[model samples]
Target: MCRLFALTSKDPVSPMEAIKALDVMKEGHDGSGVGLLLRDLGGPFEEMKDAPILSGIFSEEGIRKLDLFMMDQGFMTKYKMSIKVPKQTLEGTPKRGLYLLRAYEYPDSWNVDTLDEKELATRLMMTRLKIREMGEEKKDMIVFSFWPDTIMLKELGDPMQIARHLGLDRKDLKARTIMAQGRQNTNYAINLYACHPFFIKGYSTMTNGENTAFIPIRDFLSSRDFPGYMGYQSDSEVFAHILHYTMSGLDLGLDAYKHVITPLQDRDIENHPDATFLKHLKKSCRQLIIDGPNCVIGTLPDNTLFMAQDRKKLRPGVVGGRPGMFAFSSEVCGLDAVIPDRDKSKDIQPMHLDTAIVGPDRQEVKICRQTEPLTLPL
Candidate 1:
């Protein structure tokens, strides 16, 4: 099994805090790889929130190609943060040429002030896909995310060791929200694209268990003709895509997400006040049903953090923290390591029918249980 930890705060916090929590639950994951996604960025990035930042690894040739491509597309570099890797490679880590997080100004042809949000997202996603395709043959560049106010980093090695080597402890790399995963490498090759905390557009998610229904779900998603849903390097990547599809594509409310992925039995559905809608959703999204033991933790475009369990609730997860800060971790010890001053009594371990959500306000946790009447949050 893998381990998942996510933290959201009113103020910017170092990603190292989340990494330290993963260390506290070291036994749960093998030292195969680590993935981190930071949103609501702070420091220098705070001022450039409107700029689209591209986070990835690139070779010398890849950087040259990227520069040419961006210039052709009329995108100008606004700010760049290039990490300095030591000459001596750290043990168990791959030798990477350049680790970069560069923000860019909008292309000259596009008027950002007049463009629709969806159109803007499509343009950004298409640009990222084009760049990824350009580097696929030689493996020269590996792009994780191209979004505003977000940065993604992934590498092969121990979480702490990788963090130190990448200079993640720097004060400038802080964010108000962070999601991390310590991969176990149970199945699939140890490829960087297979890392958790996958992102597309503004949705991001990390899982702690296998996705038994990956093939069917993958085929269904790919059939939708959405370019952003093409990559299935890891089984858990579908969780993020499914979220984007449900919310953005279908225009469904957040509460409908858990119901769509894990619908209730016929008997239970009949008792629900929204049974008609639930039945229609179950029938239409039957292929999207997720099987196997898993716990999904993710953040929405609004920066709302949430954790949901599978029907069997085989995996472990807990959410706890005081006002202005909240953490969703695979184990309680992970939370203790980060927010020791939190009220332990209020810690929530969502069951099979529950989804624990902490809104963008960072005020309190709201438990949305399947048994209760579906009420969409405002």
Candidate 2:
């Protein structure tokens, strides 16, 4: 398993000192990086990286002779787990702040994307604009958070053919994740959360005959979901359609031509009503949980929830997905946990909220709130 550690200090410290205090030894050979905080006195944070080799400290012992660190994946992960660091080294230097940590598989694998104080502010600017767009809708809007793998399946041509290419038995594979080398490995990696607006367009266009659209909530209101034979091709589209139907109570199709598998129900039923459309939707959503689709992204007003791994249950009040405050996690559960708490805290909340409200009407909005700048730890 790979091990990672993050550190923050009250004062600025040398990159070398930070690593040593962490008790990260030279032999670990894990790639390392140092990040500096950037702000709009100018630009975004820029990343600096170095290849890992044997630590120079180890060269004197003749185990390896190199000033640079080697990015030996195995060696780095195994030993770094137990490395220790002293807290005293964090005393007064310049400005104190938070940082990131990671274990790189290769020196070349190191990647950095930083948000400057101004950049973060700018992001909030864009988010507010989005929220405004959402608010402008005459009808309630729902977005289908498409799972990337499902889109990949549609992209790879017919599902059965993809299964065959992956050497997966029709009986075992669900026509997804092209099984590589006879159902042993997975080749078609799908990053569901990474789904961009372009991908949404691709998936939306796959319907058999009806003109499907990748309508941004800004432009179109979705029609209700219908059965496959009735013309609904994908659940994501259906999800949006149903939400619009629920919010508007206007049928997009005529009764003579339409058939309802699940009848549309009223959203404001005071007492629990059986056999309503809302009830049907709830039942289906619960069933979907048991069906094993990775719940990486969730659709909610003004935000979306994305997890790196499956999340069995969701805590209420957790919301995220502003442009700058992207969710980052090794697994879905990790991100779910991180998002809610981070979003609630004083530090992240203002920025997230500020972004959502600034939509199209405003050209620029200045942020009076300031967060202590952060750096990425080695």
Candidate 3:
């Protein structure tokens, strides 16, 4: 997360002053924005456009750094000057655009510094109130913002599952926001639909709030205290369903979110069965064994390559999970490799093999190979 900032006071400060205060503290934040929500003292609420920070730093003595990133990191830039630039020319023609239209038009532009007393009194106040109302209603407002990473988006999937587990459809769940770390080397920050109004990382004032009900996959599937997942190989949706069931069955808080890592461990199922919502995740393991032996593999619809395949040998094996991990393979070799139990019933036999690791999202990697009906260690 780049930074976090928030304020609640009877009398508001100038946007310029607010920007200067936050800039001084911003660690390495490349960009910043502000969300203005105004409540008319028990009357209708509204919000204004998110303001951006200019390409300068502020300190006790004034702007400490200048053009560090060399980008117009401020709310009003060459294009957004109308909102933050202030109006010297006035009258019927008006020196600037209407506050509401202007705020929404340049939703991405935010610079707290350029705003003056006149702008704040006439424009900023009313603008903030409208923006706040929208934020409260939709709950998807990007108050102050920054980009996100893949992990954060995947993490969101967990909360959606949790909502479904509790019988809440995608539409029924309350509003929430998530943070995504950028992929390339850029200042990272969380994106949110905020209501409570808090600071980003530390200094950036944000409109988006932490509203998601889901937990990270690692945390969600960490234990066997809940019913785990089971599904056809190569089907992420099915895996999600089983996970939802496990969390719901165990009564692990209806609104709670859970997460599971890729490539589940055998011990996750062999042990800790009593600790999870779904104790008998392996009951469906036989399907992998029954379908395995030899097969050809292909990519998913998106064809983005999300996993690495490891096929040591074509072996007759069983497949299960750490409760939340699902098998994904052309035949079932991948499943056998992960969960090999050759005791109770082993009707299927392996002859050749092909392996590929896929998902978490959209990617795949192939590794190793095999030949002949092989026996695997349980």
- TM-scores for every candidate against the unseen true structure: 0.98, 0.20, 0.20
Winner by lDDT: 1
Off by over 4 Å in 3: 5-24, 35-85, 88-255, 260-378
Write the residue-wise lDDT of candidate 3 on 1-378 in tens digits. 222221122232222222232344334233322222221111011122232222111121221122221133332222211122133432212122212111122233533256563343334333333333434443322122121100011111122221222232222111111111101112222222211122121111111111122222223333334322211111121223222332333333111111121112355433432324222333322122112111221122111111122132332222222222322222233334333442224222222232332332322222322221111111
Task: Name the lDDT of candidate 3.
Answer: 0.23
**TM-score of the candidate numbered 3?**
0.20
lDDT of 1 by residue, 1-378 (tens): 888899999999999999999999989999789999999999999999999999999999999999999999999999999997889898888899898999999987999999999999999999999999998999998999999999999999999989988889998999999999999877788999999899999999999888989999999999999999987889989999999998888888677789978989989999999888888889999999999698999999889999998988999999999999999999999999999999999999999999999999999999988877775432
lDDT tens digits, residue span 1-378, model 2? 111111122222222221232123212212221111111100011121121111000112112211122223122321111112223332211111111122122322322134353343333223223322342332121122111112121111222232233232222112101100001002213221111111121111110111112233212232222111111222223333333233223322211001121222234322333334335444433322211121111121212221111122221111232333332221233234323444423222222111111111122212221121111111
Stretches off by above 4 angstroms in model 1 are 375-378
**lDDT (Cα) of model 1:** 0.92
lDDT of 1 at 195: 96
The candidate that wins on TM-score is 1
Worst 10 residues of 3 by lDDT: 147-156
Better of 1 and 3 by TM-score: 1
| Per-model RMSD to reference | 1.1, 22.7, 23.4
How many clashes show up in model 1? 0
- What's the count of clashing pairs in each model shown? 0, 20, 77
